[model samples]
Target: MSATTTYNGNDTFHGWAASAKGAPLVLQEMTLKQWTEDDVEIKISHCGMCGSDDHYLCESWGPSTYPCVVGHEIVGTVTRVGKNVKYVKVGDRAGVGAQSGACQRCENCLTGNPNTCSDLKGFILTYGSRWPCGTPSYGGYADKWRGDQHFVFKVPDNMTNEIAATFFCAGITTYAPLKRTDVKAHSVVGVMGIGGLGHYGVLWAKAMGAKVIGMSHSDKKRDVALELGCDDYIVTSDKEDRKRYFKKMTHILCTGTSPDFQWEPYFDLLKVNGHFINVSLPKWDFPPFHTYDILKNQVFIHGSAIGSPNEIREMLKFAAEKNVRPWIQKYSMKDVNKAMENFRAGKPRFRFVLEN
Candidate 1:
């Protein structure tokens, strides 16, 4: 038999899958992509739930490929590793994030930004994606996960799987932008939203020695933000509150996906030539704004995705050293629906993780 058949014959994995758009995930059996020498198979122990999973499930981002298993922030035990896989061995604790594959030859990939690879074949998401060979890729909302070893990361022994799982997606997404903006002790950083991604932005910015200001629509997350180490909290809608911190921040990390996000007011909060990086993926298109906001102050606006493999490693080590941990609520893998319901109801203190 050929290699494809040989590999396909060895295993059929099981996971919770959505059969159609807006459908609830149901237990199902599925097959992984044809294994290659560069592949690794993991028996999942924990998986973090991200906002992106809900977007894909509800077709909020767009139409998703169905029969989709959608958890990406994965932490697990390495059950098997292909001959070519190194660093990750059987029984080792490892994790995979939002990215699964990328075209290594691309300039972005070679330069350590595989998450933003330019080629069509690159930018493979952990789920809601297909392998180049036309096989559908499943994610970590299951008993096992298989993917390119290059995208798999070894978890730090000092961290628990539940905590490590959140780092894969939420941690990297926030950490990448903070590092890129060169946030330091002198920098005053504004972290908007105070939810899943925003909480991390607040934690890491403070950990990086920057003074963090937690900005939200109201006082709901004020206590939590302060608990997460925010130097101060701002209610974005309050004009008096806005005036106190106007033009004070050196960098602002916008992590909220609200369709009604006030654009111009946030620009007003930035210092001249300051950077404002947005990491949220909202289903709605951002409202238009005036060009004067950019020309008048030379403000820089950017959009960042998840981090590279090297960045992931760096983030993990930093998180361990700093003792940074996410506030999370856990659910059994079998109760994914109930977990998702709580998520939709906005009940998570910050993030949620599923234990397999």
Candidate 2:
């Protein structure tokens, strides 16, 4: 028999899954992907809930298959691994994030940017996608998970699973762009919207020694933002105050997502050659922006997806070394439905993690 058949018996686990579009997730038995030589199976310990979870379940992004298991931020212990896997061993603390597998032969992959793998069919996402061998892919809202070893990472020795889960997606997402853009102590960084990813941006920016500014619609979050280490707070509702800081920031990272967010005023916040990165997935298309303003300020505006493996490793070490931890609430895996309700209501002090 082939290697795939040899591993057939231990090929299933259980996780909560969406039984229908926009319906509550229910417990379901999930099958494992084909046990390739590079696969790693993990006993999931903690998984952070993201707005992306709600988007997928509601078919907000696109049409999703029924019973799709959706989660990305995952931290766990290695339960098993294929012989080809070298980085993680059984009983090691590890993690799997928004992505799972990629085609190593692609140009981006060959250049150490596998997160941009060109072979769409070979890019195996952790959820709402398929494995290379055609088995359905599930996620971390469960007792266990299975996927290629390439996407699995080792958690830092001092990091707890709850904090580690955020690094998998939200932490890496903010860190990659900030590091790439050269954010430093001299840089004045503004974080827009104090949500899951935004909360991390503030802490990471502060940890990096940048002058951190919190920008929100009002002062409702000002006190909490300060408690989270924000050095300054900008009330966007105050037009004169907004005008005073024109062209003052070195970088502005936006993690808020709303159809009504005023995009025009933010362009004025960037200094020459400043970068504003969008890490949120809002449903509405932004209103037209002024080309003249972009040209004059030499500011770069673009959206960032979940981060890369190299960046993930760097972020974990940075967070671990700096003792950077985002505020997070824990929920038992069995109480996931109530957590989901709270998640949808935007009730998290910062983020939520499902503990198994």
Candidate 3:
């Protein structure tokens, strides 16, 4: 590999960045990273804001690097590409998700699970971290973003920028888990929390030929759930209603976490050899479920991260063909700080996309 070249000694791009944790994100100028042989630079047209942005901005997850630009659901046209970037080229439509790079030769990566790559020493997140070259990694809350070829996904032409952007994070997050379970026509899949990930969960489940049941706490999402192709909708707000589905679902894809939620009922809804997959990071940890239920029912509780490069490709193709779209509220990049506040309060109907 050859040495990477700096964009220009003094070249900088404009974006919204947090100067300190919990501080209002302000418009600021940031330096462009040096170009590596395997990197792709994008002039971002759309960026999907995520709760992870709020988590880091509020320091909920942990301490974050200051002057951080945080929005990972990114989509744009490729403006430049490194010499060895085989897939993406200059002027191509592209997108990137939660990750930017990973050690491609590792055991986990070799098996096509780079999202959960075991190469901890070389794993790189899209933002709130440093690149392999020690550059402070800023995410898609910017005019432009540069990522490695490995993590950048080529957006399908049929998909719009905003929809393709969510596929980078929210879409793939749900899609990966379902695909891993190999959902098919006869599968009975329940999508819990019909919001950001849940919406995608329902669409992906239905598109994958599963009989999808959208389960939310209220009736607010009933129409949206049905619009997204859910075969049935269940309001889990009533405890008695949950019992109606006792041992009904073969798999439950949990996309939202509620502190006051009763777990036993959802557990009871699972079949003898059921699977409960959780992708949401709720503030409160769930209390223990019935020990006997787990032992006797053989339930599998699975945690999924984002998808690998191969999986991303498969999902993009699937989404484009099936027109898998996210219900999004579009906001301009200038309104990001205000948008962040609302995002914390759950203002967006499903997902929020920032147009640059």
lDDT (CA) for every model shown?
Answer: 0.89, 0.85, 0.85
TM-score of each: 0.96, 0.96, 0.93
lDDT of 3 by residue, 272-325 (tens): 888899998866777887788788889988999988888899998888788778
Clashing pairs in 3: none
Which residue window of length 10 is worst by lDDT in model 3?
2-11
Candidate 1 per-residue C-alpha lDDT over 1-356 given as tens digits, one digit per residue, 9 for 90 to 100: 54446553356788999999878889898988878878899999999999999989998877889789999999999987887899699899999999999999889989988989998766688997788878888899999998899999999999889889999999999999899889989899999888888899988998889999999877888888898899999998788998988899999998884677767888888899899899988888888879877899899999999998999999998998988899888999999999999999888889999998
**Reference-based TM-score, model 1:** 0.96
Q: What are the RMSDs of all candidates, in order?
A: 1.6, 1.6, 2.1
Better structure of 2 and 3 per lDDT: 2
Q: How many backbone clashes does candidate 2 have?
A: 0
* Winning model by lDDT: 1
